[model samples]
Target: MKNTLPIALSNRHVHLSEEHIKILFGEGHELNKTKDLSQPGQYACEEKIDVVGPKNTLKGVRVLGPARKNTQIEVSLADGFTLGVVPPVRDSGDLAGSPGAKLVGPKGEVQITEGIIAAARHIHMHTADAEDFGVNDKDRVKVRVGGERGLIFENVLVRVHPEYALEMHVDVDEGNAAGVKNGDMVELIK
Candidate 1:
């Protein structure tokens, strides 16, 4: 039988408001805004940057929405960098006791506001794919991602719908830790 499992890298991300963006990036730093259909009061940034987390460094994170009282930064896999570990996506306000970050530019040093690490893990599967896997929305299970950096991820929440294809979602920190990338294979580890 053919093994449908493949290793896929995952990344973490968070939502922030314009005001919080100013607090984090400082004044004059640009914040791009894009609407998100999946979440209300959610948005995506056209510009991307690097965010350092507790265990690893995350590159190409697109900030979403305007800064709110409780804004968050989303960290995703580098798509190419391999640190052999996934860095968790953290809230800016929660980075105080966690790792700090430096904006990759002439901007010099940037301070993290929060210290929370480890975003929730979830899987993305289409309605048909979900049926194929015999899983449903909110179903929790373990996924075995195979490759040089193979790993069995547990407690993965399932999100099933028509708009989604079969895929697992992870924050950048988690992706880095697990060494995941796009087109990587992931199998239900049950």
Candidate 2:
């Protein structure tokens, strides 16, 4: 029998506050505050662009806010395709390269120099699902993403909470590198 699991592509991002944005990018840089439609307490800011990984030069991307301390830049798989890099969700301090502008507004001309960031990889599961999966909060496990681009993702942290839905979150870079698309299957390989 084939091993198959349901996977959902995370195109959503949690925002950081204005205060944290300044610390990463530097003072005087502006960050636009916006509400996250899905989750409360989550806000996005239009600030600096973060170029992750080894390749230098600006990749065509627009970083959104709220600015976070360790976790920042919420890159989509589509954006990763443009940059041609796999951005693992990680702390802001871990990101390489100088800060760049994230254009906002209608014409896509507004610029914020705060900087782009990558959040840490995590899985959110409801209480019942957590029990079914036989996992606990902060438990580390591996995820097997199957399809044309198959990969075994290791070191994925599990976050069990009543408010959360079952899903795995990865940054734009990682999604692109793995060639993951919407409605893909990601099985727990614990």
> TM-scores for all candidates?
0.52, 0.54
Best by TM-score: 2
lDDT of 2 by residue, 37-85 (tens): 2333444455444343334434333445544554344555444444444
For candidate 2, the per-residue lDDT at 13 reads: 44
**lDDT of every model, 2 decimals:** 0.55, 0.56
Residue-level lDDT tens digits of model 1 in 86-154: 335432344435323443322333554542245457766677777777778878889877667778888
Clashes of each: 38, 21
* Alpha-carbon shift of residue 165 in model 1 (angstroms): 3.3
Residue 24 CA displacement from its true place in model 1, Å:
7.5
